[model samples]
Target: IPDDLLEAARIDGASEFRIFGSIVLPALKPIIVTLAVFTLLGTWNDFMWPLIVLTDKDLYTLPVALAALSREHVQDDELMMAGSVVTIVPVLLVFLSLQRYYLQGLLAGSVKG
Candidate 1:
């Protein structure tokens, strides 16, 4: 929505919450989708924090478990590659699925004020 339209709505007595819900939220869809994708990718690929926090074997996340597996299977190149693939696939899928929104966000962020 244009600034003029928003101003008109405000002049016509629309509340801030109503304007936000009806206009701002729709305008923010692309950036919101982009952020969600980035957040999912970040969480899915996180390793160091999970490793440091979760001490129990049963509580380990995928990356931590994969790191442990790599350590245990040092001699097995194939197993290590499989672990890497497992770690990468979800991030790849998310990036592919939301590439357009991600690129849009990147471009939007790159513009100088």
Candidate 2:
């Protein structure tokens, strides 16, 4: 919807932000919340990619931090366990908040008349 609308707007000579404001974003709100939750969980639990990309402590994503903690501090380390908990909390929060729409979208996509 957004891309098609943007294409139509471009042909009509609408400015970039104007196209987005008028045609793209309004049509996106229905699915935006669900996509945002998925994005949050995916980024929060991302491990090796972040481990490979993030070298600095301040930039450490929770999954990579948890992996590093478990390896150096022992598998049973309290800090590692805490890191695991921290890594999962966002997923739980996002899932709890968005599960209704997620399930709704899933059902809608999977069902046919």
Candidate with the greatest lDDT versus the true structure = 1
State the lDDT of candidate 2 residue by residue for 63-98, as single tens digits: 777766677777576777677777778688867876
Model 2, residue 33: distance off in Å is 4.0
Alpha carbon lDDT of each predicted model: 0.78, 0.70
Off by over 4 Å in 1: 8-18, 100-113
Residue lDDT tens for model 1, 42-98: 888788998998889998878889889878888999988888898889788877887
For each candidate in turn, give its C-alpha RMSD to the true structure in angstroms. 4.8, 7.1
Model 1, residue pairs in steric clash: none
Residue pairs clashing in model 2 are none
